[model samples]
Target: MNKILIIVFFLSAQLVYAQENLNFGRQKEIISPQTNTDGTFTFRLKAPNAKKVEIQGDFLIAKGTGPAVEQMKLGADSIWAFTSQVLPSELYSYSFIVDGLKIRDPNNVYLIRDVSSVVNVFLAGAGKADLYMVNDVPHGTVAKRWYESAGLKVNRRLTVYTPPGYESSKANYPVLYLLHGVGGDEEAWMQLGRASQILDNLIASGKAKPMIVVMTNGHTSNTAAPGESSKGLYKPIMMTPDVFNGDMETYFKEIIAFTEKNYRVGRNKADRAIAGLSMGGFHSLWISANYPNTFGYVGLFSPAVLPPSNAASPIYKDLDLKLEAQKKNGFKLYWIAIGKTDFLYKNVSDYRKKLDAMNFKYEYRESEGGHTWSNWRDYLSAFAPMLFK
Candidate 1:
């Protein structure tokens, strides 16, 4: 009888201990990101049985070249945790590699998709980075608008950002044609670039004029971004050939015509601006050169102006004639920026030399890091304020 009583007492005590240790309700809090007052961050993942876990993120190092993997430590409650060092004020994306598979943070709900992959996102600080954040400012509206592309013979989509009070006001606003990189589409600026937030905050602060920002899909053959249309069911093709074939120019004209017809925007060159990053930068170059008098303001963020493989290529064939025309037309701002360590640094430098030789008046700005979105976002923040001023 005494043995039975002892066994019962032991089992009850074990049950009570297990219940106390189990994270029944506090699991969410335990695994969620905890921002410390000192500007560091603690990320936790609840994977008890995982043999190995590591955190990889853009913020892990400079140059934004990461999968800067850092091993996570296992805690008492089987939660793996990693604390980041004092990070700078910016938005960051991170994911966990459990065993060998890459996975996003289940605790984090804020995510941004790039190309076809999605990752968890978090903001590290305030103040300078607040432009990228959703502040208590009058926000703009971003809409996915479809238009018939006469050039491609397909219905195309683009993202448009209308400033606050635009719905109620009958004001005719200036337009800014924003372009994305090779793998990006209309949604790139809206999602990754935080175009709406940046424009909203800048306009609220009186830094940037209230203007309509149009983000277009640079892909010539595709109507919209991947998975954004029924056409996306077909295999994606390379846009490089189409770009060189002058299909983009036709697409550009179609988009411009559509914008003029649909939106209450200025018609003249003085009220127009165009800017892009990487391949979009290349598009901006070709587009601005092709229609020299169309845009008053031009910005190229880490433009991919590759050295000509042969003189027969369209990108290099035009030579100085296009730039000369642009110079004659007169531009309000020809802003160009690139990271010092970017892979295309040499290409941009060589192009700048050509510009210098031609006396092509341009504002050059160099930033830190490589071919990454951080510099691209910074470029937009700086470039937007300069427009229509």
Candidate 2:
């Protein structure tokens, strides 16, 4: 009887191993994004019963607009497939619409959450956009840290990226205070912008100086990013009228202090930089102007500058004065970039005209696209290489 029991256990082990091997074989057969040799991509979905299926993605449409829909052909095996044209080399967010309900690619495991929505992601080609892609290079470390905000009366969280060998080396590094736009948190730059990978590749290639990049949550009312607060509430903390008045600029000083005390970063203005996109661009403008001589390098990507209707307001008056003071201080780089067709083009153009009138020394650039992550990522790629030089 003992021999029979041992035989049964041996047979069970064999059965389990065989089952596992079969499952692995099945996994190898699943492919969603099948990249063709000519740079086009074939995305497949196994919705055999769906009457209508379509594909949409960032690569297919302009920024800030709804996805450009492309109908997928139903295959003989009931699988739905769509082959894209030769797309540019870049990371793209996409989804499948089946019978009018949008869904992520089941076979594609990579995903990203923008605001409240989650979408599948894919990388195509190896062009200038390859800087954003992850390569076999020395990688940096990205971490989320909480700091006590005395002004806001809450503990706020920010994402910090330390360059490779930061842990083992005892070197002081310059810090770039990177900010994100509205509806985005500290994670936006790392996720959507792929800032970590960009820095890693640039630093490895000797194109960019290795530095610590601090991504701060710009929303003054919220301690952390959306859905990341300790209070278990997803709703944003609404700022009081007073806080909206000018508290954001003041609150930034605390963030800088916290970063300096906690990290081995330079404390001088020459060792500091500030840049952001959209609302973040606005913050960068406000912070750098209000706090003169704070950052040597300032970047504004598609800045959301409102029309100058209230030239008499104290804020505008203060900005005017601050601009002159900033110019006198002699900054290293004051860079502004906007998409030609962006909705905020007029505002930025008007602000540029004002700066021109003031003789404020700044570099202005215009690209092909509108307000989107693509332009912002490209802006960072261009701007970072010129920092701390």
Candidate 3:
């Protein structure tokens, strides 16, 4: 009788312990970043001991003062909350500032890593941001690929996205060589820019034709992105030893060779496109100019138009001559886009002036925001639809 009573008591105690330790009911009660009916979002943070709380995100205008931070109102329930005005349809990232330290919202699970910083993310309305969401449309395949680079003397890694029905169909598709910025790696476009999602959505909507996207890591100093190579778990840096020295543009042929040999893609010039953001834009400009007729379509999204201060490399030599040659060589498109407030706006404008002087025909697009993933994603959406047409 005593043993039975002891076993019952022990079981009851274990049950109570499990409920206390593992029960998340209280935490689940806190719903944050609630997308209200009117297209606004209400962010909530449960901070009982925090004396001050604020919300900072891309949704608010920075106005050159860094991120726009808004104060949150604390209620009697010890929860701090802030309701934003009606936001446009876009994917936005934000963090909570509890008393001074910036932190992610505990309630939001969606996060994206931009270089070394990680932040929580949420979608606003249902317009432009619909491309960023993984809708019920036919999806594509994103794979990590490694190619031998004889110039760099290492096996470099890249990301490739094959459009939907690629595996089942024997049809050859056009190729788009997508490049990333200085601090980004092969994964940057897929993660922050939502390249695959955007492509899937666009192709489904018939706005863009089926194509293959090869996302290359432009930082040649390392063989791959941080922690994905011999360099183990090292923190990412903005500058690389081989960057801005024309090495990437010089050795870019290996990437094209690898993609052509392995993937079922068209080899014609018109079937090839190259485009990138920021530093990648600089690379695309030079690569297409140096190897004329290789890529019929070229896109420079907020490119760093200035040449390297020390242009001793032969690849950087006779750039104006190369531009003249590229102009003479017939191509389908040379598209340039930039945000009005981007730091590179002046540089791009100056480059446009140079192009005007040479009477080069190119299309230009101007957006509203500065250098950001939002603009880059939007650029990809607009640029992809015009290719191979």
Candidate 4:
């Protein structure tokens, strides 16, 4: 036993020495949800030079809910370290706020983009590092098909999610156009959110009505992208706006035309719905509002639609996003969901107030969590049931 103990200690020491010699940079650091008995996880950062750093993210960016800052300890060679307990069994996007500017966690491995070119670190399911795409279940089908863009003169990719019996069933299905946030693409929904599995589970459980979910590469051109932010997890305070009417609008129109013609789907706009999260949420709101005849159901989930300076909106002149002009012809269901603690919560509330004042009726559902996929999944699980009803 003593010999085995000696060998184990020796190997652990050697591993520690190797990690120290390699330095923090250019090394893979493992972090997971790491849930505790009390149902929280600690986010640990081993920064060598950070005078002051705090973990900020979509789920727990609120003051004092993040990583341990006051408890930060400077170890040998200026290694700054901190740990904080967070609610476990959920995905969270987090980054270190050094001094004041936001930066990626030097040790985090999980990264997913929310907008045009921006990314935020994410962790899930407390414990050891999870193999990327390791969780497998009978997932919905995801297909990437290329089509010629008449407006762009280039080929484009659009991702489509089909539930079970999509091929076997002879009947047409209702379509839901799902959009991604900035810095994301049509693939983001499949890879990052695991939408197909979520939908499949929902349908299998008979919780959500089965429908074809269409995800297009929100990137129409170089300017518009799936990732549209610089700082991850924080309010999209740092990205340029890509206009909704530009490639996004054209892409949607073309994709719809192609899908309806090729797939078994209802042609009537009344059978169509559009919804998205964050940046994609904004796209759904504006596009559906501008072209009310295009969709019968619209959902804005944690949408960002303040002034153009808010980063989710592009620069445009006095254009009417208010759809009171077509309310009579507008959507059958307009569902708006925003986390009560979401950064754009107030803005959404103000917009809802304006919507109410204009007598534009819609449904507002507030949740307890912030703008994370855990909540977004719940949003999807809840919202899809009401569509095409």
Candidate 5:
């Protein structure tokens, strides 16, 4: 009887393992590497027998509006090396992949809570650019609540912002899901970006509509932001997509669910809109495009497109929603704006060309400044009037 019991336990364990393995499939997971020096870093992974490896991040996109300078070189020791001319001191995040699995940087000293996940990175600019973070504003409430994930068997915490009128009015307002760039948490929009104040000023003056702006953390994994240590450039291994995951695609999947349950928002796609900046812009382009029926408004600010068929990501194949009708009629507004001098400007152009190639109609505009908060603020100010009208 004891032997029979042991056999049953072993069978159950194997079945559980099989179920978990099936979900992960045969994809290889990514792992973050440590920094070596101030301006140089080595990715010490024995992926020699693998097919391909690469690194990428928001550090390049935030520099200018034209095109990001993504640089990578392999060392004689089979380690991947990368460098940049002016890596800012802001908390930028990056990741690496081994085979097919995604992972975080092993050398990061800076970390912030990205919803339920922890991100790694080195802070380059410190408190100089807290413009994207939330400060002690006069009026507003920052609510942190946990959401359940029955499939993953976990409860996740999500941060939300309710404006001044949120308590007095029972009216359901149009919801705009604002995402952060690489290395930034969901709080980026509320804090450094000053979204709450911007909206408050707009609404107070009757220039903008009163609505709830949801700022949720965008990082989907434990990857670190740019620069792990003072050695600086030596640790460029955090640039790959493997580390950042597919970004808000999964976060949205959960966040949309959470928003629906807690907030007074429009139930359908027409009342819901999405927008982001930099890495968040890339995510916006991908998510809004694939899920046209899910969002009536789509805004892209200083977005960086990967290239050619690479498009904006989530890979066109993965986005199963058909958008032909939406392109022609479903969308209320498809807006994109970029600074002429921004390094990501070319990416914006590339995205436009791609959109033109597909015959999708959109409003693409060019501005005068580079990649800075001034341009972003102006863009948001201009963007608010066009929403939910």
Candidate 6:
């Protein structure tokens, strides 16, 4: 009976191994976004029955208001191909439209989700984008942890990054609270923004100081990111409840308290920084202003300034008073950046005017793109180097 059992187990293991091998054998040899020697990229798609195929991506400059579109020529081998011009060193996202329906590249395995849309991505090396790449350097560790929120009355999720040597060293490091925009959660910064890679490269090069980065979900209604908490695998929406009502700003202290207790981080304001993009920028502005002594450094990237008229929360009240108090209390750095063509340009301009009227000090940077992740990532690379300096 033992011999028979052994034979049956051997056959089952062999079947499993054979199935794995068969799956590997079925992978195709097609490659998309092939980097050429001349710094151009070639995209390929195998669509035999399709009459026409086109490509839309960030690599091409937008013609008017819509995205840039380029036609791909179909070859004799039933493949569509397009080669781009000599492009700059950057990360690009693209999708193929086969017969008017857009889809990701089947040959490319790498992709990222922005809100609800998913697109394939590729990196062109040798310049500023190198900061987004995983280099041969001392890397930091990223962990997704849950902490109890006293104010929110629930367990919440946050992504934490510990700089290299943190485990072995006995020193407590400064902390940067990095928030994400609307529809984003704790995982957005590390996933879409490449925050971990940027920090790893910057700290390894000694451009930025070694510090801990805490990324939190700004949505107050949700316990965690979609599919990560009590909420099941439901579709994620761009708008959520209590975002602009200042609930998150009022409860942010709980995150800081949790970090100080759990991580090896400094507890004082001088050792803390807060920054975010778009709606996140709005949060940083209020969180830093309302709790004047909490964060020494504040950064806003393409922020949506000004509260809605309907917002009646006390946290939204007394804006000028809070700013005056924050200014009198003093802080290390207040940095603001916006793209030239951002939809919120006028809003940010009005915000600047308010700051100017009060003689509030801040450093402003204006770049070239509209509201985009590309701009945000660049802002982060620039902003991080100036922190804990």
Better of 1 and 5 by TM-score: 1
Model 6 lDDT per residue over 1-389, tens place: 69999999999999999998987666445679899999999999989899889999999877797989999999856889999999898889999999999999998999988778889999998998899999999999999999998888889999999999999999999999998998688988987899999999999999999999999999988888888888899889999877787889989999999999999898888999999999999999999989998889999999988889989888889999999999999989999999999999999999999999999999999999899889999999999999988
Pairs of residues clashing in candidate 2: none
Candidate topping TM-score: 3
lDDT of each candidate versus the true structure: 0.86, 0.86, 0.91, 0.68, 0.61, 0.92
Question: What tens digits encode model 4's per-residue C-alpha lDDT throughout 1-389?
Answer: 69999999999999999888788644435453344566565555656656776655555534465442233455554545545555545555666666776667655556765542344555455432122223443456778777767877767777888878887789999999998776567777666676776677667767677799998766565322223322223333223444454457535687888888878999898889999988889888777765668898888989976436433334222335447654768668889998878998988988888888778989989998678666676677678778777
* Each candidate's clash count: 0, 0, 0, 23, 54, 0
- Candidate 2 residue lDDT tens string, 71-165: 99998667899998899988888999999999989999999877778899988747867898889999999999999989889898999999999
lDDT of 3: 0.91
- Winner on TM-score (1 vs 6): 6
Task: Kindly provide the TM-score of model 5 when superposed on the true structure, using C-alpha atoms.
Answer: 0.57
- Residues 143-175 of candidate 1: C-alpha lDDT, one tens digit per residue: 999999866888989999999989999989999
How high is each candidate's TM-score?
0.90, 0.89, 0.93, 0.67, 0.57, 0.92
The pairs that clash in candidate 3 are none
Those runs of model 3 whose alpha carbons end farther than 4 Å from true positions after fitting are: 1-24
When 3 and 5 are scored with lDDT, the better candidate is 3
Off by over 4 Å in 5: 1-139, 150-154, 222-244, 307-315, 318-325
Task: Answer with 2 or 5, whichever has the higher TM-score.
Answer: 2
lDDT of 5 at 238: 26
Off by over 4 Å in 1: 1-23, 62-66, 232-243, 306-316
**What is candidate 5's lDDT per residue for 1-389, written digit by digit as tens?**
69999999999999999988986663323223443346333333434554545444445554565434343455554545455445543445555554555455554444554433444444343332342333444355567666665534445445576766677778887888886666465565654465766666566656666666776555543222223223344333224453234545644667788788888877877778788887778778777755667888888888765534644544445432334646745788888999989988877787688678778878987898788655665577678668887
CA displacement after TM-score superposition, residue 195 of candidate 4 (Å): 1.9
Model 6 weakest lDDT span, ten residues long: 22-31
Candidate 3, residue 219: the lDDT equals: 89
Q: Is candidate 3 or candidate 5 better by TM-score?
A: 3
